[model samples]
Target: MENATPSRTALGVARMRALHQFSPQAGLFRDPYAIAILGEAAPAAQELEQEDERRQRMRLFVASRARFAEDWLAAAVLRGVRQLVVLGAGLDTFSLRNPYRDLSVFEVDHPATQAWKRKCIADSGLAEPAATRFVPVDFERQSLSAELAAAGLQSTAPAFFIWLGVVPYLTKEAILKTLSWIAGVPGSEVVFDYSEPAANRDAAGQAALAFHAARVASVGEPWISFFVPAELAISMGELGFDEIEDIESGDIAARFSEAPKGMTNNSGGGHIIRARRTA
Candidate 1:
C-alpha cells in the first residue's frame, strides 16, 4: 500500500537525522540506519563537516533526546514493560535497534514516512526485527485507536507511548483525544515533547520552527497546537493522569549533552513528559 504522504518537515527531519548519523564527528548516538535512510550509506568520511546552522541545531537537539529516549526505553523494559509505541516514528530506528528483543514494538507514522523508512530498510538490506510492527496513519484522515486495533493492540493493555516531535503538530483537541485514548489503555504511560510560547516567539527559535512549519503547512499539515509544559501538566492532571514527570529541553541538554559541559545551545524548545494515567 502506498503510504499517505507526510508533511515535508517529516522528510526533512528524517534526512537531518540520517545526515547526523552519517557524520564521523556525530558522537554518542549510533544509528546505522540513519545514513541508509538518506540513501547515503557511504557519506564521504570527513573531519569537521560544514554544518547548516538550522540542521546542526536540529541534529544536536534530536540527538540528545534520542539518547534520552533510548535510556528510558531500556529502563522501561527492565521494569517489565513489553509493549512499546512510537508515535510519528519518522526515521527513528529504535525499532531497528531492537534494544529489547523480547518486547513487541509498534511504529506509527504518516504512510509516506513509513514507506520511505521501509524502502530504506529494504534497500540497505538492513534487518528489521520481525517482532516489530508498523501502523500507518494520517491525522487528517485516520483514527489512531482504530489503526492500532487493526494491528491487534489491546485497548486495556499497559504501554509506553513515545510521542516525540508530534504534539506540537497536533491540535489541542486531537492531543487530548490521543491522551484520552492512551489512558483508556490501562497502565499506559506517555512520553512526549511540547514547546513553550517563548520558544515560538524567540527570534532564532521562531525562524527555525517557521522554516520547518512552512513546509508542514504547505502539505496541509499545519501545527494546530503549542503547549506550555506547566499548563500541559495541569491539563494532563485534569485528563486523569495520576503522575507526571517533565523534563525541560534545557534540562535534557544539560543531562545528556555530548557537545561538552556548558557548551550552551539555546534552540532546544519544549519538554518531554512521562505521564501515568491514574484514573
Candidate 2:
C-alpha cells in the first residue's frame, strides 16, 4: 500500500467480488452493491467470460468469506451488538447495504484507499449510509486503536469487526496487536481470514499460492505471515477471546450449498476465522 495510492491488491479483490455478482453461484452471497460500487472500474464482460478454474475459486472464496463474516455479524446483531467495524475495508459494501437501522458502521482503511472509495461511491451515485463513518489510518505508521477511537468507536460497547483479505499481509506482531485491542472491548467479536504455511498446501495449491503471492509482491505488498490454525486459536485464547470458529478453504464451498458446480474446494491453505471476546 503506497502512501499516495490505493492498494493494488485491494483493487484486484474488489474486481473479484464484482465478478462474483455475475457468477452462477451469486446465490451463495448476494451483494447488490458490489458491482455498482466499482463504477467504471468493474470487470468487463470479456474478463468475466475468460475466467478459469483459479479465478473461479478465488472469486468464490472472496464472496464466501464475506458471507461467513456477515452471517456472524447478523448473529451478533441479534445478540445486541450495535457497532460494526470493517477493518481494512477495501471497497466493501456492507456499510452501504447495512440492514440494521441502529448498527453504526466504522470503516477503517488506508487514507488513500478510503479517499478513492469515497470518490467511487459518490461517482456511482450511491447514497452514503448515515450509519457509516470512514476512518483513515496507515497500518504500518499509525495506531489502529487511536484512529478508531478518534473516529468515535465506543471502547466500552461491543463491536463486531470484519477483517477480510488483510491478515496475511501483516506481521505476526501487528496481527496480535490488533487482536489484543479487540479483546479489550468486552463482548466484541471479529471475523478475519489467514493462510497456513505454503508447505501445508498441495503441489498445485502451492503453485497457485506462489503465483498470487508473486503478483501482490510485485506491487509491494508481499505476504509476510502464515499461521497454523491450532496455534492461532491458542493465541486467540490467550488474547482473551473465548470462542473461535476456524474454517478451512476446502470447507467454504460445502458451507454455502448454492455454490456453482465447478467451484470445488481448493487444496490451498487459506482459512477464515471468527473469534469472540465474551468477558
Candidate 3:
C-alpha cells in the first residue's frame, strides 16, 4: 500500500464480499460478479481471505451494510424513487445488478477511484450499463450538487443516496455541509455509516478501535469524526430530515438472524444511518 489510493480500500471491500459469497453462512446478499471484477488480482485477494479473525469481522460488517443499503434502495425504487446516487461508489455492483430498468444510477467518486473502477468493469468484459453514469469529483474540493448536475442528475426528482465507507474519514464540517445540502434537496434520502464517539467506548472497545484506526491511518486515511447517536438524531432533525433510522450491530444481527455461528458482530464499530427529506 505504498502508493496507497482510496480505491485500494474499495478493492479490499470487494474482496471481502467475494469471500462472503463462499461462506456457509452467506445469503445476506450475493454479488456473483465481485470476484470476476477483481480478475487477475483475485488470487492474491483470496489468499488474504483467512488472514485473521478481525479482518473477517470487518468483512461481515462491510457486506452487511451493503446488503442493508441495497435493500433500502430497492424499497425506495418501489416508492417511485428513480434516481440513485452512490457517493464514494468505489466498486459497488448495484448498477450492474439493478432490476429497475428505469432507475438512473449515478456513481460519484474521486477521479482516480472512478477511473480504476471503470477499468475493472472493462477488464471483466462487462459493459457499463446505459443507466449508469460516473461523476468524478474531489469530495473536499468540489461541489456535489454541481458535479451531479453536470452528470445529468435532476435536482427536482426524488433520489436515494448510498454513502458507505466515506463518512468516518471526513471532517465534521464536511459531513454537516453535505448533510445540509442533501436536506435542501426535495425528496432525498441518504444511507451512510458513522462511528460512535470514541470517548464513549469501553476499554476493550477502545483497544479494538485503536487497532482498526491504526490500520486505516497507516493507509493514509484516518477516522476523524464520530457521533453520539442522540446528538446525531438532533442534528438530522434540525437539518430538515423528517425521518431518521440509525441501525446498530444488534439490529443488523437481528435482521439477518440466520447468520452462521462464526459470524462476528463488532459492537464497537460504526452504525448505519438513514435520513430522509420528505418535504
Candidate 4:
C-alpha cells in the first residue's frame, strides 16, 4: 500500500459497489457516481458475483455505513461547521453526495487513489461537488498538515473529518499524531472507525477478522492498529478531544434491523466517534 497506483482506487470503489448490492433500498442514497467512482477492477465485486451470501452481507455493511457517514455530515453542516475533510478517501461518495449545501469539503488520499477517483468521476461525466477539492499526499512521505495547507486548508477553521474503515490500517503513532494535530486546531471535530483489539477474538471473531485481514493483505494493505472502545475514549481525551462516544457496532443496524429479536454483532464493527477540540 505504500507504493500505490490508480488501479487500487478502482478496486476500492468496486468494493463499495459489491457491498452496496446488499441494500434493497440503495437507490435511496441516490449517489449517481457509485459505479463511476469504483471503476471495474474490484476484487470484492468478483467475489460477490461468485457467492450470493457474501454479496448480501457486503450490501448490508455498506448500507449501514453510508447511513452513518451521511447523517453525520448532515448534522455537522447543520451545526455550522463549514469545513469537512475525508482522510483515506478510498471510494467514499460524501463529497459527491454533499448533504450540506454550503460547506467546503476536502478529500485527502494517496496520489494514486486521488488521481484514479478524479479521472473516473470525470470520465463518467460526474462533476465534483461545487464545493469540493482534492488533496493528495503520500502518507509515507509528507506530513498531513503540510499537505493540507498546500491544498488551502486553514488550521483555524473548525473542521470535521470523516474517516471510515480507515483506522485499522494506520499505525498507533500516526493515528495519535493526526488526532493531536486536530487538537492543536482550536475547534475541530472528527469521526472515524477503529477495529477492536485482537485480544477479544472468539471463534466467530477470529474467523471474521481473519477474513478482513486476508482481504486487506491481498491488496497490499495491513491492519496496523486496534483499540478497546473504553481505551479509545480515554486516548481521545488525552489527545485533546473533549468528548468521545463509543457507538455500538449495531447502533446503525438497529435503525434498520429486520430481526424483531434485535441486532446481532456482525463479525466486527466501528466506533462512530465525534470528538471536539476545545483548546
Using TM-score as the measure, the top candidate is: 2
TM-score of 1: 0.84
Per-residue lDDT of 1-279 in model 3, one digit per residue for the tens?
222254667776787787777765468778878778888765343455455766666777788899889988888989999999999988888888888989999999888888889999999999898999999888787999999999999988889999998888788988899899888878999999988876878775577688888978876777889988999999999999989999875466677865544544444556888999887
List the candidates ranked by lDDT, beginning with the highest. Answer: 2, 3, 1, 4
Which candidate, 2 or 3, would have the higher TM-score against the true structure? 2
Per-residue lDDT over 1-279 for candidate 1, one digit per residue giving the tens place of the 0 to 100 score? 134554566666666666666654367577777766556633444512766655566666666667667777777778777899999987778887786767888899888878877887788887777988899987556899999889977677668888887887777878898898887787778888776664555686677677756766876766668876668878888878988888765564467545543325455465667888755
lDDT tens readout by residue for model 2, 116-219: 99998999999888889999987777999898899899999999999999999988999999999999988999999998888878888788799778888999
Clashing pairs in 4: 13-38, 19-59, 22-59
Per-residue CA lDDT of candidate 4, range 28-96, in tens?
344555665655643343454564543344445545555666676677677778888898887777788
Query: By descending TM-score, how would the candidates be arranged?
Result: 2, 3, 4, 1
Give the distance in Å from residue 43's predicted Cα in candidate 3 to where it truly belongs. 5.1
How close is every model to the real structure, measured as TM-score?
A: 0.84, 0.96, 0.93, 0.85
TM-score of 2: 0.96
Clashing pairs in 1: none
Root mean square deviation (Cα) for candidate 4: 3.1
lDDT head-to-head 1 vs 2, winner? 2
